[model samples]
Target: MRNFVVSFVIIFLGFTLAIVYHNNNKNNMVKAFAITLSLLKPTDDKSVILINSTIISDFFKKYPDLKKYKSDVSALYKNRNYKSIWYDRKGVIEFASLLYSKANLLNEEGIESNLAYKDKIDGIFGKKSTDKLSPTDTELQLSSLYIFYSKKVFQGIDTKKIRETGWFLPRKNLSYKNLLDSLLINPQLLSKNEKQLFGQYYKLREALKKYRLIEKNGDWNPITTDLLPKEYKLGDSSKTIGQIRQRLAVIGDLKQNSKSNLYDKELMAGVLNYKKRNSMKMDYSINSMLIQRMNTPIEKHIKAIIVNMERCRWIAPEMTKADEYIIINVPSFKLIFKRNSKKELDSDVFVGETMNETVIISSNVTQIVFSPYWNVPNSIIENELIPAISREKNYLEAHNMEWKNGKIRQKPGKKNALGLVKFIFPNADGIYLHDTPSKSLFQSEYRAYSHGCINMSKAKELALLLLKDNPDWPIERIDNAMKGEKETVCILKKKIPIHIVYFTAWANDSGEISFYNDVYERDSRLAELLISDDSK
Candidate 1:
């Protein structure tokens, strides 16, 4: 009986301990599950809320005022898989801060967009607010900001508006969504060196800043000379010479402010550099024209810089992708042949006059015609040739011109208007690059003497360079063809792309900025368009 009682008590104690342990384990598991569920639950705070397509649609519906950017916003969100891009668990990501700062400085980028809801953005960032924002408002506002920035920085004015401004250069079509994707991946792209604008645009912008600083410093004092001579040459001595030295120093043409009252060799060197930059006759003489150019107001220079930056926005970035290409800057009156983005040839070119401005377009040069006939356009025939023929009965024989097929044509000879060669790139404007017989005109300071075509100063050199690699056209054969009386046509194996552009201000490879006269009076028109729209 004693043994049975002891065994029964021990078994009861063991069963009770087992029950207690199982209950404790069950309670602990229930507590752990409750904590995990709390963590997984969506909260109004300390969590990034997703913005799906339906949410975006509802948000736009509530705020119909932002409907204009609905498509762009939707596209952006779709690209991001309907996730919160500008927010995190703490709200408003770091890039939002960077973007807001950049948008506020739009003017520095030559953009004129009035950032909408700028005050709200400033308030959001200024307070570093941790308060939960309505996800709808957050997504919409951030998307709007992205669109505004991309449009201003990546794409300039609308394509139609740019075309209306008479710029026909191929405009780069960019996808804002792609740009945003890049920024989301790497926010440091907001840096000036990594900006979305072209490399040349930034150089011009830097120049703009420098010029504005000069203007703010009251610019240079005007050059006033009591004894204004016909020309001031090297080794001249006068008070005007001192003023010239100071002026050159102010504009950075001279290394130091000599403060001398004599035109020494040092000052002459500065004058030569200045004249070269200004596309003037590079001589040691300082004339009235050069003085006038120097005295041009700093305000005008600033305007020119801003205007050309706008022009840069219209250029396609892919233009430099070609293996070989030609560029004719109309305002500079220069032609550049580039191979692998390196300048192969630079030539002086005479573009059309103001009344007959050269068309801004791109075409491919297909053929080179040596000793070509000039099929005079009807306008020139009726206006010039007929009148000349009436004045001189032997005008046709005297000028090596003849009447053929009821149209006037100049024969292929020394007296031909198109000297010894012509480059043909067929376009609707009836323009081509040709050599001119009146070479004296090229030496003039301003060479806008063409009727609507370009006159090349180094036509023979251009021909040799273009055909140097061709196995068929040797140097001797090219010369013989150019000297031949019959018209000889040689088609190129690879067509060279040519772009005729007009820029009143541009930067060189060394980032030196040059400003030219608005020879066609097109700056004012473009400026008017730019200023008229608050969003540019």
Candidate 2:
């Protein structure tokens, strides 16, 4: 009787164990199927039926790095009545995918700063991400992402810091809250929101893509300088010529690399195009300096492209709306005059040297002074004139300068430092565009010789363009005023907007990009600030 009772207990325990194992397997299968179903569904509006408001606060508490956007996230949800914008019952929404892709491409947008909580954000889309985030967590993640992208790409670095980067252009005032609302409604504007950015930003972004590809391919090989001669002219042949040809083809200056050692016509054409784009003297001769410029690492070019893209973000789209405007790119040493969105004139210009950097500011050209007297600034007089006077007692008399009310001023004449014309725009910096007596300076490839003012190579042409339509100032009268007999001022009937900007890299809509020398050495400074706090 005891043996039979033991056998019965053992059989019952084995049967119970089998049932428990079967149930556990069935439960896991059900959980996996539920996750799959959530992903397959088109849209489940009820998933966010009513998220708990405390979840928003809890999420931020857990991810304090994103806390800066907490208010924005909260306000966004409140505007949506706490419904999940980034999701429905079907898991993350389709729009969420687009936002995710854009966030991952911040570098393409010229932003070095990474989104806070990047790993968690990545986990939301990971293969194991399904069923990981509650609806509220996913919602908050995307809201913060939108704000981060909008602020960094559309608005740029913080206001105070951007100002510190020496950019004084009017910044675009974007409302991320309102922008989110529009994006949610249309979704396509997320990609086509050119109205929110300066027109040039898109151009630079395209250049960045090309340069990054070049960098990835490792096409930029520094030429073997010691092996080559000092210069190569037409018909000259060397291994260095082949290297330069390869470089030019890589950058689209040449149609293709003939891989020839001879400096033929094809290579000369490429060299001329390269020189024009690089702000170099347009010549066919390949010199050591030109080869050195060609040898600049592709990485530096990429950085320059990225740096200029940041500059584009700081500009307002409306700044380009004016029918007539003037843009003086300091690094390019060129001034552009546009009327009705067409190029009216393009002229060479010389800006301040490193010691006296020209101020980057925008104002209206309200006045023009013909044969303007040069009222030398106190700084110049103390730093330059006093020493000259000590060397030569009659220096002021010889230079056509005299004391006026205890201040020395150069009299208006052919030899006056300000030449025959000047364009004035009101600003505290006292910087303006004017003519220079030294016409030969503009011929130089690198022309930073002024003292905090722009020396226009075509000042007379610009003055004539500005006064052409005015009946009061005819061609002959304008000509007479520019003869240096006396100073004459013309108040403009319509004020033309002038923006003096600094950009080492500039691009056009036609897919052409030009890299100029960093005259003020501002690119590295701005680049450092861009990546300084990215780890945080």
Candidate 3:
């Protein structure tokens, strides 16, 4: 970080001096370039400023005509106002030095700001969500963001905040520093790169206002114990406020096991429930985790939300005013179908299990295959099928599936592995919508249990919606496809957009957030890295 910062300052100052010298003279491009080279040559700070004598003569030699590109560089350097500009930059740094009393500064991919805060800058100390971001934070974040972008992700003007559908595969040890270093080395410029870069330097200070790059490393541990009390009790009305504080610290059994003990069972229960709902254990033990959650001043949560808001910005906007669209939240184990701005179908879904936790991916539903054949995944083939086949040769025929390319292929029938139907969505994640035979598995709270395909409980409804635009032909056609001897595909009248996302915390239309368990354990991991010691 120090090396990069030093190099950046030198490069910026070098260009400023060069342009100033040439503006006063007719032809001093080489001299200006040479002066910048000299700045790079010496390690001493005084030596750099010593070149002023050479610059003055060079400037007089070439006058105003050469100064055309001056303002484009640094305003002060361009207008011959270096002293003022230098002082301004110096003052800003000094202000930061005094302000940073003791804050954590970390940069881990898994780190995230506290999820329950919004800072109170000028306003009264209270909770509030603002419209925009911090100009300083945005400016600070851009340097790392662009560096990461140039290296790791493909460059493109995502129409809007978009999801990186499907699981991300790594080429090496996946660490925060490793990723940042990779991005710094890989300089990928997104479309419309020129304007974005040239203008960023001018508004660098202000841009920080638009983003929440700095998050409170407040006290909250998602994985640890952070239970809230469900009830509380009071008996001595004469106790002073200070006395109550001292007594409260020692009172452990909030339930009031005995009549003499002043306790609130209900309050303890409610608090425990809140903790459980937010992914904490239900033990009602306010350990380090609970302490952390309490200290997470509201300002922090707001910032975390804004950073995530950028993810949405990367996606191009879209409208689904027509027929219903299906959204399967991979992390939440739920599927939603909406129409006319209202939810028509919502159901629990069983996704890939622990060992087979589903990968994040997306695609459009082109068609639904009724009474479909199930071509088993290779994992199942090697692990389950081979063992069964070794035990009994007739096992393969009893299931109606045949061997193809060393795979256990189940034929379309009542006993087919795909259950009764399969929804195909062409996606890079190799994921799709389908039905499952293990219906009982849906009852489990932990629903990651597939070979990556989403097992939909309302497969029939989704199928009908897919073909809602089709005239005349309807659900009966789908019934016939099942009865027919050959496996059939019901083509949709039009292609439908299917978004498979992984949002663990999101507000509904009422602006009240409903958080689900992070079954994939992604939330805690992301939160940690995002809140590393690099920036607290």
Candidate 4:
């Protein structure tokens, strides 16, 4: 009887162990079938979905611990919206909790999306409720990473160096306040693509520094250009001025002249045009002025070019209105006005001479006075008058000039220095647009005939437009202003901004560069500095 009872217990235990083994094997088979189904994609779809009973069996086998939690990830598969990551919405919440373990790193906006909070298990990781308006940190970092990399790649900022400098050296730590103040409300300066806001990453300190020597001295000399050592490359080309002249000599545009003092008109004009294009004067001579540009350190010029490139990037590509605005190429001594982005007016302008060079400026026009009085500057008296007075006491009266209270003034009339008209705009520099009696001087290719003011070739058209807004203005009225009369002031209803600048060398719209004479003698000074290393 004892043997029979032991056998019965053993048989029952054996049957139970077999059943457990069978069940375990069946569950594993279901999981394997679910995973295998992924390899056999539907003919019409990019991925395969398992709709058999194996999916549920596999779901339990793979995520056996889900029952202990409040949710199951099988729902993602059911919804057919599983992302690339194996983690579903619930898993994302759990993972995020581990990331923001730091307390107070974020505010109320952060808590709703906190993955660590058990209350958000059923809630989707990135699903927005009425309270949340933005993505979670995970999404934000991922999306912004692309933008950050793209910006770094496009701008070519040395990211490795930037990162090594604590990530703030070149971006956040800028002299933004001073630059903002200096710009004085030109919002575009700051509106540029946020990359250069950290006080231009490059430096043009030497180039500007070398060029400014002329600003103080009014001309380039050995002290500024020739004495310094510099090497510059325009754009991507590596040819130097000497190398370029050699190449051009083959074409006869330049003669193979090597003396520092000697330069032909073709070489001279080319250098001048470069200056003009670069916002220097078109002196139309390759003297000291040409040397300045040629000698500026390449690094400094690169910085300046980068800065201007950023500036141009900020400007709107399209015109705002269908109106007229004129751009005077000071170095080239040319003016162009666009109407609806089309060239409506074009003319030549006589810029300031080197001794009394025109200041670079921009302002709106207030009026145009035709046949206006010439208020002789004291410099004229000191330079031209005192010398003339020393020669002939009657010279002042012959020139219609008078002195009162130590001030010299010229009255309007035929042979008056101001000629038929003077276009007026009040500025600190006392510069204006006007016509000159020396119209014959315009025939010369080099036209610098002003004392820090602009002389327009088509001053008559400017007069007509100044009076266009004035309903009462007529030709007779203009003629009266032109007739050897006293000073007349014609106020403009709509003022225009006039920019007097200097640029000597510029590539034309047709891609061919137009060079000018270096009237200011700045090129030679700059070039000397550039070749200072080479010459030495």
lDDT of 2 by residue, 353-428 (tens): 9998888888999999999999999998999999999999999999999999989999999999889999999988
**Native-vs-model 2 lDDT?**
0.84
- How many clashes does the backbone of model 2 have? 1
**Best by the TM-score measure:** 1
Question: How high a TM-score does candidate 1 get?
Answer: 0.88
Given candidate 2, what's the lDDT at residue 359?
A: 89
Off by more than 4 A, model 3: 1-324, 404-407, 483-485, 528-536
The TM-score obtained by model 3 is 0.49
Q: Best to worst by TM-score, what's the order?
A: 1, 2, 3, 4
lDDT of 3 by residue, 97-175 (tens): 2111111111121122221111322111122536333433222222222223322222222222122223332111222
| Position 457, candidate 4: lDDT | 73
For each candidate, what TM-score against the reference?
A: 0.88, 0.87, 0.49, 0.44
Give the root-mean-square deviation of each candidate in angstroms: 9.0, 10.5, 16.1, 19.6
The TM-score between candidate 4 and the true structure equals 0.44
Please report how far candidate 4 places residue 235 from its true position, in Å.
Answer: 38
Q: Report how far off residue 281 is in candidate 2 (Å).
A: 0.7
